[model samples]
Target: MADSFSQAARAATNELRQLFEPTPLQRNDHLSAQYGAEIWLKREDLTPVRSYKLRGAFTAMAAVLAQRSDQKVFVCASAGNHAQGVAFACRHFGVTGVIFMPVTTPEQKIAKTRIFGGDNIEIRLVGDYFDDTLAASQGYCAEAGGHFLAPFDDADVILGQASVGVEILDQLGKEPDIVILPVGGGGLSAGLTRLFRETGAASSFRYVEPFGGASLTAALAHGAPETLESVDSFVDGAAVARIGALPFETLKNVAMEHVILSKEDSLCATMIDMLNVEGIVLEPAGALAINALEQIKDQVKGKTVICVTSGGNFDFERLPEVKERAQRFLGRKKYFILRLPQRPGALRDFLGLLGPHDDIARFEYLKKSARNFGSVLIGIETTSPDAFEALFSRLDNAGFVYRDITNDDTVAQFII
Candidate 1:
């Protein structure tokens, strides 16, 4: 069964070649050397839509249109890379599309989706959140009698996403010892896993999810789809509250030990690493697979491992925040609430104790506590991690009362 499924996927991928060239299977020297393993990236980030979402959209749409020629209208709701994939695929198929996005989506993404679809699609700015936006799109789809394309959850969509796996096998000329995949709504991972199993490749598998949104891992543990109480939306691409039903059905049997949770800040560090070292821009979700390597280093060393850097639809406006997160993760930067003497020479004395490389980035007087002291919030950036240690030690020696707020989510969200 696995061999036949793999064979069918190959045929599908071959047919897809007419649509676009194969995404690269580039061996990354920096990552390989860092991990002491043959680390190859499937480079799904280089696809036409800068994501693997396009492969599934194209395959599913083609199969559907071939059967129902009159199904000319398609609808989908997405606030990120998936919308662009559907828009691009809509234009490719010459079908009319309605894309609904949350009002909170950045103008840059909105513009890019419009540019990709051109005259073949319409953009709808719906609710403030994704769930509401999706509800609106579903209503519109029912009223207009169009097919609602799920980003994941559908078997056909999963089969369509399987094209990535098919291409990976073809491009590499051999099977990898392990494959690390990033999980979002689960379409890509489900499709790839099914195809690999069908191909008789029990390649060791590792699944990465954002620390704030480990839906796939959660589902596998519970042996069912489970909704998270709350999800952090930092890695917007993979910030799903729940795994897709069909996806969980296929993935639930995988061992919990193989699923890894990537902290958002740590993912930022990898994003910075890829951009600086490889000149490759990756969205947070795209960095998940690579970030998992540090945790699995001992197991992957000297093995042929492939990490699927999922998507590159990164918005530059978020670059500053990414950098800040990276710095925090690396421990070279910090924020704090400091209690200092209000006397004129007190501020000067505090400044004099700082290391030469320590620079104050932000300093705001929060409140006046007493006649002799004031509360201040300060953010510090340093050239080296040890600079912070030196600066903090000096502050302690000087008897300055301070609370480190760098990782304080509640305060950082409002002030940082």
Candidate 2:
């Protein structure tokens, strides 16, 4: 089975050359130095569609076309990389493709998908959420008799994603000591796991998932795939509520300890660092594996590690939010509610308590809680994380009442 799978992967990879060359597997010096390990990145972000989704989309579409040469239409629902992948594949195959995306999807993504598909694909703005868009697309496919292309669930899609593992082994010329992969719906991780196991590679694996969308972790816990009650969509590319059934079949044996749940905000710091330091732009999902290194640096030190930076379809519009989240995660920024006296100089007194390096980023006055007191939302930015301690001490010494709501998600959602 291993040999056969390897052969199939090689074949798919060879066919993929018709679309684009193999994504780079470059050794990263900065990351290597930072982690005290030899760190290499499989640059899937450099793909034509800026993601690995194209590999699976093209392979799955090719397989369908091979079986049904008369097939004229393909259908998929995606707001991001998958939509772009399918659109590109449709144009290459000269087939009519219907790409369904949520109505709330960013115009940038929608426009990019349209540009990829050209005249061969039609963009359908359907539901407000992905689930609704998915259901609508399936119904449209069934009604139109068009082939439905799943993002990660199908066997062919898994086979296509396995090609990444093939490329990794071939490019590295030797097995890595460790491979850290970002997990979304499990297709990429499952495919690579199967390929490595089949090839008998000695490398161990660590799977990284966004903390809010930890379907793989949940699956490992429940002994089967389970839908998350709620998923944070910040890591939009990898925020899958449920792991794919087909992929889970291949990944069911993975140990719970091998999985790492990365905080969503921490990923912003990784993204910002890669962009500013390495000049690499990455989406939140793409930063998962790299961000996870901080959690396992002790174990990976002195070893050859490969981290797959998954996608780079980032919208610059979100840069401010990313910076904010990154600062919050690093403790360089904070938000708090202060109970201030309504009397004169109260604001001045509060401002005077701040450290010299502290800068107010936001100061909004909420309604008055009493005749002499009022609630003020304040956001502070500082040069160092430790500055907050001194500032808090000063606030305490001044007999000021305050609530640190920086990490309070409920209050943050409402105010921050």
RMSD of each: 1.6, 1.3
- lDDT string for model 2 (1-416, tens) is 34477778889989999999989999999999999999999999999999999999999999999999999999999999999999999999999999999999999999999999999999999998889999999999999999999999998899899989999999999999999999999889988998999889999999999999999999988988999999999999999999999999988998888999999999999999999999999999999999999999999999999999999999999999999999999999999999999999999998888888899999998876679899999999999999999999999999999999999998899898
Clashes of each: 1, 0
lDDT of 1 by residue, 266-355 (tens): 999999999999999999999999999999999999999999999999999999989999999999899999898888898898889888
Best by the TM-score measure? 2
Show where candidate 2 strays beyond 4 Å. Answer: 1-3, 368-370
- Highest lDDT against the true fold, candidate: 2
Model 2 residue 289 lDDT? 91
Off by over 4 Å in 1: 1-3
TM-score, structure 2 vs. true? 0.98
Q: Looking at model 1, report the run of 10 residues with the lowest lDDT sum.
A: 1-10
TM-score of each: 0.97, 0.98
